[model samples]
Target: MSKQNFVIGLTFVIGLIVGGLAIAVWPAPPLSTPAGHALSLRVPKNRQLLDIAISPDHSLLAYTAITDGRTRLFLRPLNRFEATEVTGSIGAAQPFFSPDGTSIGFFSNGFLKTTSLYSDGATPITICAVPGTPAGAAWRADGLIVFAGPGATGLREVAATGGTPVMLTTIDQDAGETSHGWPSIINDRFLLFTVGKHGYDPRLTLLDLETKDTRPLLLADGGGFVVTPSTLVFARRGELFAHHLNSKTLKATTPKNPF
Candidate 1:
């Protein structure tokens, strides 16, 4: 073979080998394990741990423990199995991690707070204050916060940066036979968690942020915990399902007593 052709062939083979080596050398993302490793011996029994939330990075787990009819936020490391109380405030509900995992967003004292996990009393920044109890909280990918509460007319959206929250849902919008509870941002749209007489008919609906075009994602399933525009993880009955935001596909990924 000619020297020119031989040199070209050798270069191409070297490039292919280098490309594979690069991939092998790179580090992999952290893996998430189930939250019941340490409690295997102590409290081998698990009950309905409501309002479970993981840090944005999936490093921390925050959930509400409804013991004796009172709700409190518990923070536990997602890696090692151990639970701790993060807040001692009255009526603390729905503790969620910030998208950056640097802080946690929760509702207490009729207001939403952003607390840093790495510091001691690092000053819980206020998101907004409303009338009812634990106002709903959901963090956006860009760090914007959205909380739901019964407004003078209906549900509203208060900014996480501390300001007025504009009403995002109408009083007339019905969920089975009830009103809508706004959850989080989905597909650059709004997702509301609504309950009715039909035994927790969670739905995945949409509203055009710019044009206000309302639509349904899933009609009669449980609500969604959306992580991105084209992806969502939702719990129905006792199972978790992954939803493709575009194709509308549902795939279950959970064990016994899921959701």
Candidate 2:
């Protein structure tokens, strides 16, 4: 088998027990990993980090840090650097930078407001276009911003500067399957989100802008996917997954469970 195929085959398993907040889903079965291990890092004790954003050039990473009823944004250089608290005591999470690297976007409003990042510690400009809680910002390559929100379908999108947001999912759904995880961008024109269901399972879907279609990538837990310059890295169940953007091949990336 090709290395990429082997990577996908051994990356992640969709069916495993996470066990939190009444976690339950349709059994997708456990997948195995034969490839080498993907690197892993533990979230700081008592501080739950979520919605990680790696820069397009892969130079830095930003994510939300929450604990003790407080939330803030953190940043870390990818190479041999400890993560630093970027904004302390700010009710911010789910951060994404603009295409030009001059600005960042994250939800600041307790009700999910989009705020732009600036260097001079200036007040963040609220982008009235998108309404969100935590999972409210995704920066596209062209500087267009998309975010998940509450509306007819529990998610919406707007531009970076601000304007009328077009709902991504036509069907009404919960914001997250578990614990309000943010929507992940699959590519420039596509994204991945979940539709919550009771007594059944949350639906993992890929959103296509051109077709206005949300394709099912998995049943309940196919949410997190990181896009490197050349590949897309994801984790599922007890393993990791990768899809090469250049070759357009899907593979398992981790030797063990990344989640």
Candidate 3:
């Protein structure tokens, strides 16, 4: 071969070998573990525990415990497996965490109250005066709390710093939406709740917070919890079920069979 052609051939062969070695030595991307680990939670023995809430960071668990014939709030670190009672409160329930996870908002007696995870006292934010009891609550990132209002009136919201709550949405009697309750925020702009005349007829409804418009999302509902931006878990007739949802467009897909 000519001297020039031989040199070019040798360089091309060397370049092919280097490229092969680089491909073989490069690391593959890490895979995420989709399986869950089993951890048995030790619930309170005598107290009827209800309305459990986990923190945004998944480090803390809060729930309502009916002990000594009075409802109270309890919190426990998930790593420790022990529960601590929240003091300076008179009957509390339906606990939800703030965006930062440093504080919790709950319904106490007839008012909405907020208490820090590291503090010993709770401060009332507004007089909900919910007859019978409050059904559900959700806290927003912008320091506003949406909760169930008195006597199936509708949903109400108040500043986290304490103020009079303004009505957010009310049931349309003409449409047969007799009452509204059990609210859960699907996103910053939309809320998921139940609206019906009776317990057996509760239906899942979506509310647009920005425009104050409401619509039905599911025909049956007990309580709806947002598992992800595109998924929701709801309870009905003592059974749990889930559905795929498009939060951006306020649309829900076919629900899976209840488990």
Candidate 4:
């Protein structure tokens, strides 16, 4: 991989797990070095967490930090030495970058909003009105944003420019899934998300965007996942793992000593 691609892939794979706590980014199981370890990223002034994200170009890092009982968004240039406040207000969480990485989408005060990295103030995109909270979200290459629906209503999608989010799939209550969230776009046609109750083990579900069909992908136990060009990384039972994936089908293949 080129230096730029390496940075983007690394950020996506690691940022998936930086919610609500201080954490370290590990090499994708396949990329483990001889020492089988990776360097740590120290987040500054981090008290409580909401979410974190990286731009497509791997130039910027955005995250939410709680301090003085108030939540705010922070941004830092990966090549720079310090972080700075991006959003002057509280309530922003679940930050995601636009496809081109020029703007950021987030959930604040029960609504979906976006703010330009070069401008000021967040603009409301949609009134999701999700009860409790929306579980997870992702931005598509074709300008669509997919997010977890209110309660157990499965997943929903809306235009990146803003509109009513339409239901993307139906939830199967009989499957023992309490709700679905943490959606990550696997490719142009597929998405991966988490489904389960708070105390129960959560599994990853793959959604076919074209057919709206859903199937179990893996047991994540309510953790996060990411799909890179040559591997699939996921978290389960507090451990992170990577497995070989058929590039075309995006399905797991036999394990190869990852990396």
C-alpha local distance difference test of each model: 0.53, 0.51, 0.68, 0.67
- What TM-score against the true fold does each predicted structure earn? 0.62, 0.60, 0.79, 0.78
* Candidate 4 weakest ten by summed lDDT: 30-39
User: Candidate 2: which stretches are off by over 4 Å?
Assistant: 1-51, 66-69, 79-89, 111-118, 129-136, 150-152, 172-181, 220-222, 226-259
> For candidate 4, lDDT tens digit of each residue in 110-211?
777777787764544453555456666788999888888667677888888777788777777776667877788876678888787555678877878888
Pick the TM-score winner: 3
Q: Tens digits of per-residue lDDT for model 2 on 1-259?
A: 5533432233222111111001234334326622222223356787865555655544556666677777777766645347766643277755766765566677766433334345444556666633443444567776566666653354666766767667555554353333223465655666666655545554555667667765555443335454343444444443454454443422223323233
Clashes of each: 2, 14, 0, 3
lDDT of 1 by residue, 1-259 (tens): 5533332233222222222212223333226522222221121134235455656554566666555566666677645567776645345666666667787887776888777787674557777776675335667665567666653244566655678778766655343344455465554445445433244554555655557766665542334555443445554443444445553432322323322
Report the alpha-carbon TM-score of model 1 versus the true structure. Answer: 0.62
What is candidate 1's CA lDDT for residue 18? 20
lDDT of 3: 0.68
Q: Single out the weakest 10-residue window by summed lDDT for candidate 3.
A: 13-22
Question: Residue 241 of model 1: what lDDT?
Answer: 46
lDDT score for residue 175 of model 4:
62
In angstroms, the error of model 4 at 113 is 0.8
Looking at candidate 2, what is the lDDT of residue 195?
A: 58
